[model samples]
Target: MKFTFRKYERINKQKEIDAVITGGRKFFENGLLVYILKTDRNYSRIAILVSSKVEKSAVIRNKFKRRIREIFRLNKYKIKTPVDIVVVATQISVRQKYKILEESFLKILNQNGILNL
Candidate 1:
């Protein structure tokens, strides 16, 4: 899979984010929270959120966002259905390792039947 995160693949609009949060089904594993809403597009779009409540430092928050985005980018192909996915990081995620985060993310995807593998 190409490991590029493109602009079209990102859910950046506030209205879109709100729709996903309000209309999507939710899944939680470890410190990772996921909201998924089916869309008409052929490919999935994603948003990663690292709240200030999770970490006070901007660097820490960005790190979490990057890690989650990387995980999603790498596993994007596993999702057969077209959907909008929003990933929210918790305070515990600030200190967690990338592997832990990846595992938790995959677990939630599997639970939601979004991951083909």
Candidate 2:
């Protein structure tokens, strides 16, 4: 599988993000928060959010986003459902290792019944 995060696979518009946040089903595990909404498209789209409340530094926030994005990018194929997913980072996320984040993310996907694996 290609390990690329394409533009079509990302939720960039603020209105879309707001809609997902407001209308999606929410799930949380080990400092990782996920909001998932079923979409009309055959493929899934994703957004990664790390607020200032989670970390004071912009660098740290960006790092968190990058890590989450990488995790999703690597495991995107595991998800069978077509949905819009918004991933939010919490304060505890900054301290967790990459493996833990991956596990937490997969747990969320499994709980949502989106993971095919």
Candidate 3:
């Protein structure tokens, strides 16, 4: 598959904030807490937030975001809805592996009833 979450799927509306924050369920793991909210669309969007306090280097922070994006891209087939997903990385994730991140992410999707299998 072509691993990508396409630009069109990105959520940038102000109205989505509440659903992303309050309505979304939290999925905790060593690296981050993933908050996923279901949207009434045909595709999904992803937002990643990494606190400056977690990593001092901009390059490192960007890398984390890229990794998260890749994870979502590669696993898009497992997801079934056009949900809005926000990934907030904790300090622990800075030192973790990509596989671990993917596992944690998939676990959250399953917990939130967003996965297909």
Candidate 4:
């Protein structure tokens, strides 16, 4: 399986983001709020949301986004089912390291049966 977070593998449209954030199943743990919507599409897509509450600086916010995206990008191919995922970083995420965030993210998905791995 290909492991890449390409442009097409990103949820960029406002409508798509809203749909995933509002209509998907919600899971929260370790400073991450994840919304996952199962889809028929063969490929999965994702979006990372880091609000001002998480960080005041754009650099920090982007850093968080990149970390979350990397976690998703590396393990996305392991997802048994295709899903549109929206990951929102809570205030605490700004203080969490990438390893902690990744572990929490994967654990949540695995525990909820959203991800095969």
1-117, model 4: which lDDT tens digit per residue? 777679989999989999997899998887788899999899889988888876888988998888988999899877888899898888888678999999998987897687874
Residue 28 shift from truth in candidate 2, angstroms:
0.8
On lDDT, the candidate that comes out on top is 2
In lDDT terms, how accurate is model 1? 0.89
Q: What are the RMSD figures for all models against the true structure?
A: 1.0, 1.1, 1.8, 1.2
Question: Comparing 2 and 3 by TM-score, which wins?
Answer: 2
Better of 2 and 4 by lDDT: 2
Compared with the true structure, the alpha-carbon lDDT of candidate 4 equals 0.87
Candidate 1 per-residue lDDT, tens place, 1-117, comes to 677988899999999999999999998888778899999999999998887877899998888888888998899989988899998888887678999999998898888888898
> Which regions in candidate 2 have their CA more than 4 angstroms from the true location?
none
After TM-score superposition, what is the CA distance of residue 99 in candidate 3 from its true location, in Å? Answer: 0.9
**CA lDDT of each prediction against the hidden true structure:** 0.89, 0.90, 0.81, 0.87
Highest TM-score scorer: 1
Which of the two, 1 or 4, has more lDDT? 1
Candidate 3 clashing pairs, residues 3+ apart or interchain:
43-82
Lowest lDDT block of 10, candidate 4: 108-117
Would you list the rank order by lDDT, best first? 2, 1, 4, 3
| Candidate order (TM-score) | 1, 2, 4, 3
- Give the C-alpha miss distance for residue 61 in model 4, angstroms: 0.3
Better of 1 and 2 by lDDT: 2
